[model samples]
Target chain A: MNPTVNNLAFSTTFNAAGARYRGIVLSANVGIMRDLAFNASYNIQSAAYIGIPQDILLQNTNLLDGGQITGIPLRQGTAGLSYQQRSGFAARIDTTYVGSNNSWNRNPFWFANASVSQTSGRVSVGLGVYNLVNSAAQQYGLIGAGVFVPQNYYGGGAFGGPTSAIQPGTEEYGLPFRQYWLTTKVSI
Target chain B: MYHNHGYLLSDDFASAKNDVGFGYTWLHQANTNGQFPYILCNGNTQNVFGTYPPLSLATASYFARDTWMPNDKFSAFATVWVQRSLNTISTHFDPRLSLVFRPTTNDVIRLTSGRAYSEPDPSLLTPAPPSYGSPTSVNCPSTTTGSGALVAIASEADPNLLPETANDVELAYGHRFNFSTSIQADAYQSWENQALLSGNVPISSIAQITVPQHLIAINIFSA
Candidate 1:
């Protein structure tokens, strides 16, 4: 058999395209008491491609394969309550819920944040806590061979076959499970 | 006809406050060469390699606005905008109307409606054509195996993309309970068409391995 006769090659390309995003956001803020206030918001979004190549296999039925448009969470929400006093004291606790998103096979996760601050004349001191739950979530990933070189025509080193293994595309990870920091500000 | 405030109709027209303004805006993309740099496996550019696309384009818009306030109780405002671009929809017209009504010292109502258009991203407006490279076998430094074979890849650009447009209307009401407390509520609805996004395209395996075949590939790069 002639190696040149059976040479089979494959490549990938992108085109300027269009997609649709439809959704509604509802938010509310209310006073629980003279010194306490509560606020929350919820967003519901549906996205689809106006025009997609019909040949590509659909990885996600709920979302358009190429049109899924990464980084957009279908459902996400945050709620928080705050308390303040005239004597220069304030505190707040808030929780965020990120619905399961397919941007990079990321699962749903919830995290809470809290902060306390006190102000005296020209100085203010505060402390904050992030990712109270400490959940390890993957925010994004790449779908292709795992190598980091120029291979095949697409740009990265080639994998064993057409269906290459998926790998992490970025250095971004889910919010740190639990982290704390202290902050102080002075205005003179 | 006689006026209730003892003012003639001509006097009312003369006393109304009126204002007019005109403005111009220009946006240009600094790069137009539409060149994508890719790494070549060997001396031959046809061998498999890496690539990145750069973008370039420009647009301009002109607008005029007019406001008429006959009295403190009510006012009317209108604006018209015309935008020109290099996209498929080269020209677009957008207009807006606003009405304000004050029934009491602490109560106010506002109604607004408008049509707006957003051009596609400059990067997406002009895409470089796809390139081809021949498969070459090479040694692998990272993998346990001593050698590997590189495959072919291709990309496609769309020049016929359209701009996104929306029609919106909103109603708002505000009331003041006291000097330090107030509440505001607004409800709005918008309809949009031709929104832009990234999607996968179908291409043949031959197109990727062959030399310079126009093909569309699945977007494997992540953000």
Candidate 2:
């Protein structure tokens, strides 16, 4: 029995001249009243690129072929509404959604924001709250080589048993939590 | 490290029914210095560093565009691009066309079609360092060995690869009502050829590796 599972991970650049992509976008805007407005847009696409690894030992290429490319979400969209009062006051709310791809099954997230302001003479003061929903969102998916665990590679029984899986990369959750901001602007 | 220098000249003219502009650009790019780990298989105590070969590439482009509106209801825009890359002794010609029609003050229809060329990254054009033999030293003992020797893979680089090409078309419609509500939709299709991506190919030689294709991998076995 081979006692070694020293797998090496390396990547090289090549020309995938056959990659193709297509998509559609839709957007709408409406003014509910003289001071209130809403806008939204959605995008959907199907992008295909060839980059899956082919195991030479197995002599099989179709196992991972035709899989969707990583990092590109199949569906994404955003919606927002804003209202402005003649008295120098305003409020707004927004939501965003992003679908998943081959690299990961993403969770949809939404956040809201609101602000109020008062203007006197040449000065204005405002208070705003961002990410009112405090939704935790991840920005990037894991698509690079991930860490390897010994137990996962070789089952507890023997070397030929089913091998567990390891994530090839990690995700980045860069969205900030709910926060508030205060501002004072002076006209020059 | 990379360095770039470019210059552009353009002119614009307007007529009763058309707007025309033309421009020429000249650019030179150079990749002067870089070094990276060439090969570092697991349990290999020594990592090999390879030096990058300096590269000087030149590019030139000539472009012209015209926007014509014969009447208030319809308009058209046409553009042509002629680009040359010195590294590859060839030139590319691309054309783009767009048309728009406004049936009413609140409705519009648009169509666009174009072809474009993109050059590969500068590093992709340089050849990788030659593959090295098995390392002379080992830090850890393995549990198995393969064919009484260590087998490794090396990436083969090609300097002669050409630029990728893409074609795209789009159709769009928009409508507005009461001057307060508007809806816009667009459908597009794009295809690209000569896309650049890494692939793997089996190695048939023992003491040496061939070039122009394949990826790098190192397999270490223990005893």
Candidate 3:
């Protein structure tokens, strides 16, 4: 239609006109020593700027909800400390941060996964906790633009207050907090 | 004032005796997995289920611009506005300096400069079909599945989407006649960034969106 381009309203992988995006990637890193270090990498994306089916996500709500993808912040940051003791053992503890997660897109999460590894003989074992902060960051969503207001409501009744002539459900569902996890691995 | 036009008068503004007020915002930008988790669809763009970005956006705002008139020849202006909510209301301190060049007793040249946040029109943010009271509705083309992705109309909200931020520069000229009626025309241009947009992605069946508590999006300048 002739609607103005305002919200990134459409879906990705299948976005419409104003939704076209030329995706990109970003990687963040740091080190306290050498091999005993910590690093993180994230996928930077906008949308299907130069394709067609890529525009579907922007048009169909059912697809956006089930497609396992959406417009989110592909951030995975880490903060940890690792060490090596030559013939003894190697250990490490790291903190990771991921923001802008959505539910319908299979990405409602921004958690921390810390770990510690030890190498004794030919095998190396490690364990760590994830979302250790104990956060229930739920990923949720709502209809994009089909809210029916009851006329008398002050906000216009949809979802999200900005347009809701009614003042209800201001704090909708969608969490960008941390959840915990446990991980382990062995090396030979 | 910082937020309420009178709140900028003190340091600890909460319980001040003045007319100043207070406000707050979550200031949390969408980082990952939301209504449409920003898929690393590519390099410069992100896809939610797989959509696209927009070209330009249009918006409307209701704000009380502060005005400092140091007499009549010189005056100043600034404003603190809240678009989304009481919690999201911020002092978008738009401080402006103007010169009242009165070539004739009935004419004046006004030069104004300041930063402005062009908020989305309530109509745009509210999820309505393509049209209003009119019986017409924005419908998908008759084409079911054919050529390239021609339509990209998402049925959800892009909350992380931010209100367009721009440096508003306005040059206005006002003229008043003996009849006390004045007509003013403003020539303006905005150097803008972080503008919000919505594009229709050519999805085969549907699209996904995140709309919970009105998602609050902000741009944090890291120095």
Cα lDDT of candidate 1 equals 0.56
Chain A TM-score relative to the true structure, per candidate: 0.65, 0.60, 0.45
lDDT of 1 by residue, A1-188 (tens): 12231122223323323455555666666777788888787776665455544332221112244343445677888899999999999999998878755333455667788999999999999999887666653344334422222122222322433333443232234554478989999998
Model number with the top DockQ: 2
Tens-place lDDT digits, model 2, residues A112-153:
677777887789988888777776534444443222212211
lDDT by residue for model 3 (A61-104), tens: 22232222334444434455666677756666655455453332
By descending lDDT, how would the candidates be arranged? 2, 1, 3
Best by lDDT: 2
Better of 1 and 2 by DockQ: 2
TM-score of chain B of each: 0.61, 0.67, 0.43
Q: List candidate 1 stretches off by more than 4 Å.
A: A1-25, A32-36, A44-76, A83-91, A99-109, A115-129, A135-176, A179-188, B1-17, B28-57, B69-76, B86-89, B101-110, B129-156, B172-186, B204-223
Q: What class would a CAPRI assessor give candidate 2's docking?
A: acceptable
Q: Is candidate 1 or candidate 3 better by TM-score?
A: 1
lDDT of each: 0.56, 0.64, 0.39
What is the overall TM-score of model 1 with all chains considered together?
A: 0.56
Docking class of 3: incorrect
Q: What is the full ranking by DockQ, best candidate first?
A: 2, 1, 3
* Model 2 Cα lDDT, one tens digit per residue, B150-217: 22344544577788888999999999987879999999988777776654333432234343332233
